[model samples]
Target: MTFFDEMKTTFKDIPRPEGEISTLEFLEASESLVKLFDLFGSSAFSVVQNDMKGNINKVSTKFLSDPINCNTLQKLILLEIKENGKKVATQGLLWLCRGLQFTANAMRKCIDNKDWELSKCFEKSYSETLTKYHSMLIRPVFKLAMKACPYRKDLFVKLGDDLNKVNEQLEDWVAGLEEIVDVIMKFFESGNYGKGL
Candidate 1:
């Protein structure tokens, strides 16, 4: 099976919610995000702002409901990134991070409003998606990006720090990423990656 087929088999199996934004929708959005990353493989990683916004909107709206405006949530994430985001040679990286932030925010909103089933479904799909990302997507891209830039920028750290100023839901997300950061730091400390940048 193809990668997308595998992704669909894994994520689309998630039990559906009662809204437009189903677990399948989120999974599709994640798959789209990975497609955006694939552009990097062809050295075509630039993003036109309008297209980026449209793509994010398309994904965010999949299961949207009252008080859960995908556009607003996406805008909030972009705003945070614009205010405190860093520059990377690849624009897909920024989009990927922002998309994940938006997904996390949407799930948090579900959890906050006591939509237990949908929230739990989102958590399951997201966890699986992230696992695929780390193993199938991020590792190769990270190696390539590190080679081209040779400097690692923790977008999550910068994002978490900024989001902390205005959003509380990210506390756990940031904490999780920070733990990952600690491991990366240890890897760097081992001098296997040629000193910290």
Candidate 2:
């Protein structure tokens, strides 16, 4: 089976009808995505993995506190805002979405440009998705992780023996993730939930 197939919660399985993503499912999928960093086989990616994991845990903790009200991502943030007037989980979700976007964009670049190495794809995606949000010190750290990415072919081969099948699954997975990211970004922007975040 391909890596996507093996994932307990691929983006495809996350329910996002009308752009309202299920809270627990989305967190589960984000947790699964963090595992992808392991394929790089470098300590540098631990920074990326841990960042994503921390945000996922923040959101998960909030959701677990009140699953009935926080069933959907939007509701979770809105409820948090109403009760605490704080944006802890909201900010976490914003950064988590950005991280997912970075990963999706990098994978999309890999699918679009066969000549680019994984490092190049990651760097390009990082610039496009996360660069503006990162401070100078943080930017260099993420850059180091991007530069430490595994070779393209080596990573894909580890996914599955069939390159074509792996690419197809990856494309679908990235597409699903991109759609959800776009939805959350727009939601945050429209509601001004990301203000000062």
Best by lDDT: 2
Task: TM-score each candidate.
Answer: 0.21, 0.97
Model 2 ranges off by over 4 Å? 17-19
Clash pairs (backbone) in predicted model 1:
20-62, 20-63, 21-62, 21-63
Cα misplacement distance, residue 34 of candidate 1 (Å): 7.3
Q: Provide backbone clash counts, one per model.
A: 4, 0
In terms of TM-score, which candidate is strongest? 2
RMSD of each: 19.8, 1.1
For candidate 1, write residues 1-197 as lDDT tens digits.
22232333222232334322233344354454344234223342232223345544543443243224322323333333455543221133234444455344434543364434432433453444433435565445433432331111222232234433423433443343333324323433453331211
Candidate 2, residues 142-186, lDDT tens digits: the string is 999999999998999888888889989998999989888988899
lDDT of 1: 0.36
In model 1, state the lDDT of residue 3.
26
